[model samples]
Target: MNKLAYALLTCIVILSLSTSCEKDSIRVPVQTIELSASSFTLATDSVRIVVAQLSPNNTTDTNITWTSSNQQVAIVDQSGNVKGISPGTTLISATSPDGKISASCEVDVIKWTLHKGGLGFVEEGINAMALDKEGNIWICGQNVIKLGSQGAWLMNNSNLNPSAITFDNQGFAWIGSGSGLYRYDGSKWEVFTTENSGLKDNSIITLATDNTGRVIASHFNRESLLGTGASEFDGNSWKYYSSANGLVYDNVISMAIDKSGVRWFVTTNGISSFDGEKWKSYGASNVGVAHIGLVHSVAVDSNNNKWFGTNSGLIKFDGTKWESFTNQNSGMIGGSVTAIAFDNNKNLWVATGAGLAHFDGVKWKVFDRYNHPVQDIRTILTTPDGKIYIGTGLGLLIASLRD
Candidate 1:
């Protein structure tokens, strides 16, 4: 009785102890598995990749499975090294015994390059440039030159000592030279001078067209006559304006038509705006034009901002306020801004007497004569492909902003 009872009691106690130990083990906490990356970039020639994992709750499990959607594009290793083999998109995933998490990135193996074209001159000085919607370059300067693809010269009129040239919506080229206005109809030139047309004077400084194809020319008397500032060609007749006719100055330098069809004139005195009925003048005394006299050129940006290149510096008008920039405040490179053009990227390219200045809305980068032959940049033009052509006294210089 003693031997059998002792053996049975020991067995029962050992069974009870084993059951308690199993229950205590089941109460132990479970940890979570997390995945992370050092970097998401992958090289084209990489063979393997490395990824890190942190098991704050499950410190015993370090083994994880790496997966990828496209093995040809990229493949991951146990260490999380993603090797890029080709150009494609793939999803990388990591899994552990506890849970699974994933992160993905693309791999492009082909090289990216930006090709820029060479520079071409107009053969003669460039006075102005007007681009058509068809990518045809109509250059109005001393010589009437038209350029297109493959360096093709569509029209090269050496007889035109053009002072200002503009293109209408009808593709007709209106040229202003020492003579009067001339229209090129893609075949021949039609001369319109004071001989028959109603031009106030023979010398035309600038030419602009309204939305209705009405042409306007800024005329200055070579003899320095006062009260003879501007003239307009209404398809048939010419109308002249001056101080006697409510003009601020008799010597007009530039002309521009705003988005609202309002004509703006820059004269030797200040800036004048004409709404086809009334004329309003603004100068240093009233607005912040930098100078009351000698406003050389005027251009309107896509945002309806007015840019004035005056004898003093550059002035910008935001319809409500005027902001002036010079060599001191802005990296203008020169005090006298001669021409201004806005590129497709909304960057303002300013040509001054010293060099070329580029304003990316916030920052300014000045390219002087030392870095580029930008001195005496009389005109700034942008091609359809975003290439910049600068017309200077030296000749025509081209550069690419993408580079």
Candidate 2:
């Protein structure tokens, strides 16, 4: 009786233990899912890994399916890695295999968002860049390239050898080229020359528009008979000015108009300003303390202050006073200033032969090949939305200044 009772009791205990172990190993359903990030931004052709946390930590089905709402904007693999394809917004979701529990993250993909350039596209570097009324970027090189929501596209303006471009008050694009002045009204292109319009010469080089809706064109010609000068067009009539008139030099490098409608022109030797009736010229000799030499570009800020970019440094003239900044005193990256522009936040961005310099009215930030991928910056332009378009010898460098 003792052997039978002991065998039965051992079998019952062993069976009970086996049943308990099976119950402990049973699969548990996931109650919730949480992602490591709620929102993030990534550049085009960039990737980021996000982790998912499942509730009921001991759930047996821990597998997650990653998906993107817009594959053209972004793509998510099975392992929760998100890759940006283009510029737009997309939703990335991590869901349980059964599709009941899920978590999502908002992703913003930007193109040329980082320290990237248009190497193969904008070959030979971008000669000039401009922003249209719709916030589209128009770049001139060997050809015309447009960067907008549809991406980059070539305009190929019939090999006109476009040198400069500007937008008029009506949003019409006025391009100065080797042959003549070309105007684009968003659809068609029209050419203006000495024979067709009021222009005295056909060789247009630099162009600018004033707040009064007038287009100013500068022409450079080496021929003894053709000459070099600048022209003003008021939609109906043309007025010509040259060194023979009041300009300090005939070869104008760049031009800009101040807030008071005074046109400022920069030449290789000096600076000139015309107020529709009189022309005033300034040189190193007349402007005391202003290191004005080999002036490459000129820009008028919102305060009507004239900023000149020169081979030696930068000069600011407030009509009565003059100020100068160079690599020796300021944090300018390069000695030779090529271009200058102001952003939406009133930050001044300067392009030089060596690198790019940013001045925030109090502090200065220099970006060169050592810290940034861009160097030999030829031109810099800032849009209203805080995008900085830099044209360099390597290519076109695009960056954002938004906080």
Candidate number of the best lDDT: 2
Candidate 1 backbone collisions, by pair: 48-81, 49-80, 49-81, 49-82, 50-80, 50-81, 51-79, 51-80
lDDT of 1 by residue, 28-75 (tens): 222543445322334345454545454465444456667788787678
Give the range of the ten consecutive residues with the poorest summed lDDT in model 2.
113-122
Cα distance off (Å), candidate 1, residue 137: 1.6
Residue 347 lDDT in candidate 1: 91
User: Which segments of model 1 are wrong by more than 4 Å?
Assistant: 1-124, 154-158, 223-227, 288-292
- TM-scores, in order shown? 0.67, 0.69
- Model-by-model lDDT, in order? 0.71, 0.81
CA RMSD of all predictions: 12.5, 11.4
Q: Write the per-residue lDDT of candidate 2 for residues 1-403, one digit (tens) a residue.
A: 6999999999999999999999998989899999998876676667889899998898976987899999989899999889978767789999888888899998766555322345326466677889999988888777777788878877663776677888999999888887888888988889898888888778777888986779999888846534387999989899988899899888787899888888898887788899989999998888874568688988888788888999889888998998888989887877788889999888888888777777877766665543355566767789887678887666777775323
Q: For residue 229, what is the lDDT in candidate 1?
A: 77
**C-alpha lDDT of residue 127 in model 2:** 74
